[model samples]
Target: MAYVLTGCVAVIGSNSLGLGPIAPEVARSLGSTVPTVMMAAAAFGLGTAASALFLARHIDRIGSRRMLQIALALLAAALVLSALSPMVSVLIVSQLIAGIASGIALPAIYSSAAAIAPSGRESRTIGVVLTGWTLSMVVGVALSAVLADFVHWRAVFAAIAILALAAIAMLSISKYREVLATESAPLPLEALQIKGIKPLLIACGAFMAAFYGIYGYLGDYLHHGLGQPVSANGLAALVYGLGFGAATLLDNVVDRLGARRVMPAAFLATGVVYVSMALFGGSFTMLLIAVFLWGLANHFGLNVLIMRLSAIDPARRGTIMGLNSAVTYLAGFVGTAAFAPLHTEFGFAVSTFVAAGLMVVAVLAAASRPTEAIVHTVQSERQLQ
Candidate 1:
């Protein structure tokens, strides 16, 4: 789990750190506009969407740890390619490859973690693994910005590649050998047809659409829309990162409150914060608080949703997790694409409210379903196995 967690953190951090701030610089170097250059981000997400559905079942059949290793190799290659790319298209392609690699690694890791954890502890286990992800955001973007100030962006990519290689090497050690050999159940797409899974997926979809819509655009909103200084933007992100990190620690609390109760509260809080950010993004202090609260609620809700899915079919761990990530990236693409046009025409307030309302719909969908004991039994068997 630690090895998987470490690899996930490196992948998410490196990619996220370079996403927003580097866009304009890459565009300038490539002789392009921000929108054109932003294709790199979209291309990356497209890779995720493609890989998750296309390769997910195979990943389950083959073994998640094996897929994870392959993903690391691909990520390393992509990072090196990104560092050396002279053309904007090449950079976009490289990032797309990296995104696919991350897409594979994430689900594999989460499924492996869920499989190994004790009964009814999937949430706590996922929280631990996700902590590394949150920590990476806290450190990755902030450090990347600081490094970009002192060094070149190419150097940043090179450094991330080196770090990925190191994590890959660590994962190959004997201590993690067991994970590589752990058995998982065959893919069960039919289970997805079950009535309960439908509402669950819908709830998750709406939640992610809203969450990523805001997340993908927050830095841009702060920098361009709100007129904040670069450092201020980074500082606000730090607050957001802290909120994500803090939410991971709330896993037990969430479990106690029940996924049903906690989810609605989180959605409502995050939605409120999004509305607040949209309304007062111009106020530095006010925006900072809003960003923090937004991060807190959004992350708590997302992790809980992930735990719910992990429990749904514990046997088909890798496939389900892969689907989870694939669906998430797909929704992210929808959110990012939707927000671009909305921000251009209707402005942030109207668009943010719409996103917030989507979250409310998610909460309602979650409310419609009752948690069942059959899912709990599956979770137990996975843990005991």
Candidate 2:
């Protein structure tokens, strides 16, 4: 299960983080504009949203292990196609396919992790699984930047394809297959009827929009807005990645502080960080610090959201988690598409302030209900489980 989760992170991380740093290079190579290349990120997010909304419910019928195998194969094929793409349109299509594969795989990975986790340690176990994403930001983004600078962006995609293939090989093991063989139930719409769920989803969507709004164009922002070189963009991304990686330490903190308390505070802090970057990003040192702080708070806030949702209905965990993934990437689609034009028209500061506004919405929604209510509900559900 750990191996499978790690592989999912590598696949998702490489596709997502790798593209941002190399968007300019890809635009140049394909004779496309930066905004057009940015659409590829939207395409990926939309594809993932489609799968999460439509295909995620079928994971139980299809079987998690079997579905994971198919998704990995598709992801590998998509990466290879991306590497060979001759135009922006083809690259967008490849990214869409990759997103579909990710949509299919991610819920299964999270479900498997939750199922196999020791009793009373489920959140911690899931946190460990999420660390794969953090690690990917470090390894995958850095490597993509280095390759795009020195070699070619195509090499980055090809290398990730190789990693996907390796993950597929690891999935073929009988032990891993057996671990993921549990049957999933059809997604229950009633799960959405759970208390605080609607507000939580809204908050999550807003948070995602805010995060991706800035993140999607981070490379371009550095290159054009700040006049930094690609290498510097890569290094700054590395710093943010490191902070994101370090945020997994908060798993213990979430347990101690409780997600309800931590989530709202984290959202507020992240919002402040975003605004700070918007105002003071001209200073390279300040930019690095703000970006790193943004990463740390962002990941911790996301983890808290997941922990809260998982508590709502452990029996329908896959579906709930699927909804989380769907809203997240769907927001990513909107943020990437909408914010690019904002940056083009107004500038980075205006676009980033817009993101900060979205974060304000997230903070409000997160604080709408008291933590004790959620804790009571989760505790009751656990007893029933």
Candidate 3:
């Protein structure tokens, strides 16, 4: 239960620290443009990426539980600071700290889930737990926007901060103690030595550049480009969220397909949507379908990759997952930053084309892997007893 709560908290932290519904309001407050206000989002991503790389192995060495406690405290502090921030720069820095807390918590929570995998339900259970976070993001964006419109954006952030702090207090309870690691595992720095993972990281990096590029600008696209209201943006976001929810529904299928088979199909589906949108940008219905499918496939691929990392080294889960999150964020930074300039010069259609190209490459890379039932290995491990 503690792990479950913390996992959700970790997942939602980035969105909470980010622009979300408050993008316009925050921009107005800072006397900045939308693109400039967006750098806060980029900063959060960079912080997550950097911290995940730097602190992942340390969590493995110290123990996930202790790290969770510390992370929660940091998160609480960062939120408070952000709530009271007097300047945009201070707010951005606070957001970076929040990103670090998020980065630290993700691997530890994932490691805990992998550690506590019950009987034959590891994948499903993991999916269910992770869904909480995705749900938070979808809800957070829309709800936070509403709150920002009604109340001040600062109040919206203050509410999120309080929730995070509440979660921290809950996590400190004795009943949730199992989240702690028993013995410090020696960091398997050699996991980096896994020849294919580095290349896989590069491929993912490119994929993310495209992913974030489109997604980072999606709200703006709907609002500025399409002249839609925030309510419309929320509805669109709902469609995208449904896509993520759909993937969780298919978690068992994903587990059966394994990474090699699942990843390529997802990327292909994503490319199809992006290409369709690029060729015909004015069709709202078509774009909606594209966004929904893209969200579904992209998130499915993301969860699949996450599960794969959790499988790599059972005992050193925090380190591995942390490293993966770091990579994930690094990709986000590249995607967001890359898209901003592209959106400025070429427009959304061409920018989406760029994203589609990256997905094509990701599909090819995913296909190159040997498909020998990596998912079945856990079943084999169970049978060996």
Q: Say which candidate scores most in TM-score.
A: 1
Q: Mind giving the per-residue lDDT tens digits that candidate 3 earns over 187-260? A: 44565754345546655676677777898777777778888786777777778877876777787877676655
- Residue 208 CA displacement from its true place in model 2, Å: 0.6
Among these predictions, the greatest lDDT belongs to: 2
Question: Which is the winner by TM-score between candidate 2 and candidate 3?
Answer: 3
Q: Give RMSD to native, each candidate.
A: 4.0, 3.8, 4.0
Tens-place lDDT digits, model 1, residues 1-385: 5545655665666675566777667777778788777788788888977777667656666777677778878988998998898988898999899888887877877777766666666567767777766667777766666676688767778878888877677667635433332454444465465335666678878888887777666666777887877667678768887887787677888767666677677777777887887788778788888877877787778777777777766556566777777778888878877887887787767778888898888878766764564576588899999
TM-score head-to-head 1 vs 3, winner: 1
Count clashing pairs, candidate 2.
0
**Arranged by TM-score, best first:** 1, 3, 2
- Candidate 3, TM-score vs. the true structure? 0.84
Residue 29 error for model 3, in Å? Answer: 4.3
Clash number for candidate 1? 0
What are the per-model numbers of colliding residue pairs?
0, 0, 1
